[model samples]
Target chain A: MEKLNKDVWVFVEQRDGKPADVSFELLSKGRKLAKNLNGNLKSVVIGHDVLALAEETFRFGAVEAIVVDHKELGHYRTMPYSRIINQLIEKEKPRVMLFGATIIGRDLAPRVASYTKSGLTADCTDLQVSDVQYLRKDYKDLLLQIRPAFGGNIIATIISPDVQTQMATVREGVMRMEPLEKHVKGKIRNIEYTPDPVDELVKLIEQHRQENKVNLKAAPIIVAGGYGMRTKANFELIRELADLLGGEVAGTRAAVDAGFINHDRQVGQTGVTVRPKLYIACAISGAIQHRAGMQEANKIIAINSDPEAPIFGVAHYGIVGDAIEIIPRFINVFKQKLR
Target chain B: MQRCVQTGALNQSIILRIKKAAMGFNSIVMVKQVPDTANISGQVMKEDGTVNRAKLPAIFNHEDRVAIELALQIKDKFGGKVTAITMGPPRASDILRECLYMGADEAYLISDRKFAGADTLATSYVLSEAIKKIGGYDFVFAGRQAIDGDTAQVGPQTAEKLHIPQITYSEEILGIKDGSVQIKRKIDGGFEVLESKLPLLVTVIKDAVSPRPFKARRVMAYKNARTLLELEKLTEGNSLLYIDQLKDDYVNKGLYIHTLTMDDLKLDESRCGVHGSPTKVHKVESVVLAGGSHEMIEPTKEGISRLIDQLLEDHILG
Candidate 1:
């Protein structure tokens, strides 16, 4: 029955001194939640010499920033990161914490939740705070966490009614970052913490950064393929069309399974969710799994041999044909016109 | 704590033999049966955003199958047993039988009418209790998330309830050495390799490995595996067949899937199902993006030219 602090906190995820855009997005959303709750919006940044990044959180909407600076925290080792974040939560007792649903966030949030014995909702698409009656008792200021379930067929809202601190990890690109307010200023609090020796059980060996890869989430235009591409070599057609259209190339899960493309390029419920302005599907059967990721695209065009392909169900434009034959002609015309 | 013994300068196979003799890692895979969302129809979605699961056909969750496959692979290499357990209605026994066909050493179905309407929190509590009851496991495996709930919280929450370390989005088991395991996990841009000690939980992603198809002979052998509830339905009102006798017969044949109720596990009724879950659905809206106003073009050269022209006009191409 301990009283928890009344503040909204956002975990600022950064790597190599660059703050992720999702951090800003969370700040924008967290600011609104803090305003509703009549509390201060705070940001927590953990890294080596990350004070500047903590200061940057204010431009996004944070009223105050907490910086935990340590060399061991630089590279996102789970144990140290979770240990520090959990310690901070235990000491500060923030009512609600928001994290970006990135890889590091997914790993760190659950571990911290476990350490603190709190509730966490992951990959949330939307979040809000409201009062509600549960078990015939009124609970005020509960975090309403909403996310697509059943493979995006349904959206479910979840809340932790009893837990002192409610936590959620929102997926990237699902929320828009607020425009920077250069005039806004925030105070920064620097804290020093040492990592436990056990936290070093998992040692960092080497990090190989992926180069020359298309990030489907940020792409405004995406040209994706499916099993209809026929072979791994035929994926070149998808790449060619993408290149001509100045878009990124993506694929269905089947295409990734067949080794037509790397798993990174796979788009679906299990892969990256994208909201491009233009999503062009070639020979994609458009299973619900695939559609869940791209249905949010502004404009969709489907070209396939089967007019009955599910991809056309959500398409803004439909062309029934063989992609092998149709793509070459389309690519040639676009190349000529753009050139 | 069990300290790993290092046999330096010993013969390699002998070292492996000693390790295997000293540590036989048993695994428990948490499985679920989810409604197939790929082929959802109008009837499958109720007016509330919640799914009318009764109207939809349920199948074994895709990632859970992969988790079982990973468990089986670990058992194949490390010399241990794989036990699959699911908490759902009696019909969830279908997936347990499928697990048997895929080479699980034992299958368990945790069912009770009181367990209905459980959210991830309640669901994980029950699953954690079941795992504790079926003790002596060094590893617990589960899919990254069930397609139906898609919360991806149960596995990690269960790990927390059990006070065990967990690895999520695991892609591969690099190796097992010195009472620890090295796992390659998928991340946003790439993958990271991390090592954790024994008695850890791992949530496997669908991209981890392609699950092997059910063996034909094993499928035939386990196709009739039934839970206790299923057995009761069969023996009810039959003068000649008694429930206990029929259960013994199936048990003797190695075709009886073990069943557990809330009382069997001594779980608190308040924390077993809907009563324990804190999440409340505020509203449900069926999201149907408008379509059908698209231009349908022919597959000819002129058609291709027109499509390109339209794309340029719309500025989607430029």
Candidate 2:
């Protein structure tokens, strides 16, 4: 039997021609999984003038880069873009493909998986090799991927019973990005496919371009606010704290509800998932929904009034206080040290 | 930022004010009330380690209702209607009633035992099938993820099942133009704004739209909205019950559920239930860790050395 493409491939998600940080993060994890499985890490790029991006992918830890450049592919449309990925999967048949569980990953992964009839685990908080392979005598491409369950309080490891090319769409920060210091040896493999000729399943009715995320997921430090901040003006406190530490400020669903932060910055089950070196939860009660989004951070520092707030359950260190009072002092301490 | 996305024709009265006042848009919302997820613990799970759902309290999933709220906001501004739909056990009617109370003009519950244990794929099939039956919808909105399963599949999967485009992790519906909706997608680092046409589906984040309070008047009016089964319980005597009498009574009162079963959809039996599902639970292993007594390792090298030496003695060291 012919072995399907046994290489590891990753999707380099970009916005308005700018690449997302999770792409590098995915590559970092990809390097490990590939090496573990005796495969290679290949990153796929689909955008215009992405030759520079191809070079950058290597810096981000992509061992090999695949570029599919087209003017129609310049803007994101579900149909044309999904077709591009489906074609790529068919030609390359990478054994394991990773995508950032960002907006695009949320949309495109299912479409691609359904198109290819493969299994996909979405918004996975944990990823690792499964141990069941030791029981199998013949199977060679078995993978044991792990993820958080029970809304992130427990870890559940899973595997595809019998599917080729086991796929997982990972949360942005769930994996860490390797530093771009020593350039790793890699190659750029070019495969061309027509962007047109596919039946248009949907039409682009109108477009209002917005700025894209640069490093929100891979940010070294993150300052996240919750309903504790109360009003929209209060969220500025979180932003100021983040600015002092050269970090990005995120919000919980409640903070967004209070009109403190926009929906994009939300960090919870339904919001963007991130794993940073340090996660500071301010006044966040740590609802299972919110915690499911970011419990995977390497170190968690929770600041809340309720000593028993669920956020403390996952925090490496905790402070029982008000967001209004504690955040200002914390910022002062941060400024004194880092400034 | 909380723009409603919709597809399909609506009563022009809904759009007239939007065209005139330049406010509100058409929207469709998906809602589900799941057992409160926070209520599980040791033996709160059963002896078998399965969830004791009967003891679990239910709440309108905070996110899915917010998706409905966003849709309702679109209806408020763009001058349209909000239709709320839920698929779950028959008891899910509890949330459909809440949807009705929350200002959705019409509501539906698609309940069938055959739909049980549906992974995201099977659930999407049934939702898409129901959508086809309901007909005439612009945009479909679902919570970014469901609390019970948290697969985040049904929304995007349903869109795929319908062969419509979907934008997930939608933080905000920025605007709608030429029947297409533009949205700010919450990506890993920042936001990506993508535009796709009407009839698109979007899975909304929890705060995408804060839901409005249930209206007093609508709550009172639809309070008696009964399903066919409930109606049967009420009129057990009529027509013995008279089939005609029961039908007329249900029609007049508008208390009908338009109940659908596996047979009505012409579904294959092999693909409907446990047999239809491909995923199997080989075994569920629950590990309970007991917090043990603390053993202190002293600061001094000798004490620490003794601690490590003891660790090896106790077989605690690899």
Q: Against the true structure, what is each candidate's TM-score?
A: 0.84, 0.73
Task: Tell me how each candidate scores on DockQ against the true complex.
Answer: 0.34, 0.14
Candidate 2 residue runs with Cα over 4 Å from true position: A1-5, A58-64, A90-92, A131-141, A179-187, A195-339, B1-29, B38-51, B66-83, B103-106, B149-151, B167-198, B205-212, B228-239, B242-248, B269-318
Per-residue lDDT of B315 in model 1? 79
Per-residue CA lDDT of model 1 for B224-285, tens digit only, reads: 99899999999888888899999999999999999999999999998878777655555555
Model 1, residue A295: displacement in angstroms? 6.8
DockQ (0 to 1) for model 1? 0.34
Tens digits of per-residue lDDT for model 1 on A86-116?
Answer: 8898988888999988777877776677667
Lowest lDDT 10-residue stretch of candidate 2 chain A: A129-138
Error of 2 at B153 (Å): 2.9
Interface root-mean-square deviation (Å) of every model: 3.6, 8.5
